[model samples]
Target: MRAVILPGKKEVQVVDRPKPVPGDGQVLVRMRASAICRSDMSLYYGGKPLVGGEAAKTGTIIPGHEPAGDVVEIGPGVRGLQPGDRVAVYLAIGCGHCTYCLSGYLSLCSQWKCVGFDVDGGDADYMVVPAQNCLKLPDPMSYETGALLLDNMGTQYHAQKTLGVSGNDTLAIFGLGPMGSAGVLIAKARGARVIAVDVLDSRLEMAKELGADVVINSTKEDAVEVLRELTHGEGVDKAIDSSGNPAAQNAALDSVRKMGSVALIGETSATTINPSEQMIRKLLKVYGIWIHPIWMFEEIANFVIDHNIPVDRYITHRFNIEQAAEAFRLFDERVTDKAVFVWD
Candidate 1:
């Protein structure tokens, strides 16, 4: 198998590696489509930190997490799954017995392992994952659409869940990237009034096509002021920050009304908050979401299957496994909304 191995920062090569066999309770998936996430780009560009908070250290990591594939084989003791099943892989591998896992908060677990980050990932021909992490893909969906469920789509679902969106609230997302674009559709499907915010005119137009009630270009207009006026001085009911920029976070806080919730699901190295002084003063709820629980995968899978939201809209580029470096470069340039690796 040929896998892109990152031995260090700015060092990635498509090298021959042994194919992995599934262990107990695991499944070997022949990847059909795996998208390049921002985290993967960070690791490739030497911007992502090591998992243990170690700085300036990189390892032989194969980075990719958003994956959709066919089950090629099942490990021993794995039940309820068989070869030839189409599935989406959950990125987080948590100890099922941990307190965080028991409470459906796998991201907070002490031993939480994320595929493509802490563990081996789907950047190769075949990747092994826990059978429990597999969610059945709908019959008619393409592998590319199924691929988004793992991270990008799941992030939107988590944001909605975290904010307690009741389908009646108006939602605004900052940053019209893949996650933010998908969020428009998800929020609309939940019956919320959706607004998309970005500096990109094309993305804002795409968001409008995806059912956003309004679009705001923060570059040309004051986004916080516009939304406040649109809501008649009350501000939006929910605001999501996907830009991962400190300014976006502050803008989200400012754009949401009293008692409104703000969800952060994008990549952030470090961000400073004023000890919730503003949040307390405004009676706001701010949540920083990194990973969603595995169960949300199944739920989101159903949503995608039912609504058939245009997941393909996010794909502006596609590459093979060997073109990993170019993928990272193009993604960093922001020349495209989303990029994916399609296996032969």
Candidate 2:
């Protein structure tokens, strides 16, 4: 089997490795579509991974957390899933008995392991994952869309759902990267008036195509002021930051009307916030979102199907597994919006 590994500093190589056999309660997923993510950038740079612990520090682990494929083999005790079933692989592996895992918030478990970072992932022809982590894909869904559902799309859905976004809401999304782009799709499906903001014209343009009612180029205009004007001075009803940029994060907090909600979905280590003005004074409700719960995959997938979301629209590039180097490089340099490794 051929798999991608990052030796260090944005270096990717395809190396041969023995095929893995599923263990108890696990299934062997034949790679079909595995999406590369911004989080994977850490692995590309040899930095700490978004998930997992010391294990990910090794930088030898396969680097793909958003993957979907067909089950080719089921291990002993794996009853619900069988060979030939189409499923999306949930990235987190947690102890089944933990409170978080029992409640399906596997990523919140103290000892949770990320499939691609902590262990082997779908950068190869076959990857082993817990059968319990497999979510059945609708017959109408493509493998690429299935890959998005678990991570990018699912995270945005969870954030908005938590914020209770709906038809009455004017949703402002900052950072039109893949995550923010997914936010636009989910908000539109929920019937919200979508105001998409980004520093890039390319992303803002993509947002308009995805049904955003308004697109604001933050680099060209004061996003906060423009959002207020668009909402008729009341400000947006819901705001989300998917950029992880400090400025964008602040804009999300500042652009929401008093009592309006905001969800921060991007990963950021440090950012300044004016709680007294941007939060407390506005009586805001803010949330930090990283990943969605395991059980929500089915619901999110159904939403994607029911809304006829153009999930494939987010994909700007696709490469075979052997092209991992160029794929990661282009993605890192922001030349590609959403790139995937597809297998025939």
Candidate 3:
């Protein structure tokens, strides 16, 4: 089997390795599509991993969390699934006995291990995962769409659902990357008027194509002011910040109406904001949303299929596993929106 490994410091290696055999309650999948996520750049840049156990710090684990493929083999004790099942692999591996795990919030388990970080992932010809982590893809879903739904689309879906975004709400999204683009699509499906803000014109343009009612270049124009104006001085009904940027985060906090909701989906270690002015005094509701609960995959999939969401439109580039280096480079430089590794 051929796999990709990031040996840190912007290095990418495609190496030959023995195909892994599934252990008890596991399954072997033939890789078909694997999407690159921004978090993967932590390993690419030799920084501390955003999530995982010790194995993630080693930089030897295959680095791909958003992946989907066809099952080829099942291990002992596995049930209800078999060869030829088309599925997307969930990123979190949890201790099934924990309260969080039992409730299907695997990532919240104290003993959780992140796929592609704490363990070998799907950036290869073949990979093995616990049977419980395989989310069966809908018949109408393509491998590319299945892969993307695991992260960007899934996260946005979960966030918007939590915020109760609806026809009466105006959503201001502070970022226009893959995640924000997904936000645009999902928000539009839910009937919300979306306002997208980003520094890059290319990203803002893409946001417009994805159904944003208005796009704001925060660098050229004051995003908070524009959002306020668009909402007739009342401020937006809801806001989401996926840029992980402090300035954008502040803008998200400052641009929503009093008592409005805000979901912060970006992974940032720290940022400063005034509680009194941006949150407390306004009685704002703020949520720190991570990945979706394991059980929510069914609902997310149904929503996408039912709404005919163009999930695959989020992808801007595709590469064979052999082009790992170029893929990482372009994604790191922000030259692509969503990049994926694919197999024939």
**TM-score for each candidate, following the candidate numbering:** 0.92, 0.98, 0.99
C-alpha lDDT score of every prediction, in listed order: 0.82, 0.91, 0.94
User: How do the residues 1-344 of candidate 3 rate in per-residue lDDT, one tens digit apiece?
Assistant: 99999999999999999999999999999999999999999989886888876788897899899999999999999998999999999999999999999999999999899989999999999999999999999999999998888888999999999999999999999989989999999999999999999999999999998899999999999999999999899999999999999999999999999999999999898999999999999999999999999899989999999999988776899999999999999999999999999999
lDDT of 1 by residue, 133-234 (tens): 888888888888888877888888888877877677988899998889878878877889988899999889878877889999999999999999999999
Better of 1 and 3 by lDDT: 3
Model 2 CA deviation exceeding 4 Å by range: none
Report model 2's TM-score to 2 decimal places: 0.98
lDDT: worst 10-residue window of model 2: 46-55
Model 2: lDDT to the true structure: 0.91
TM-score result, candidate 1: 0.92
Pitting candidate 1 against candidate 2, the one with the higher TM-score is 2
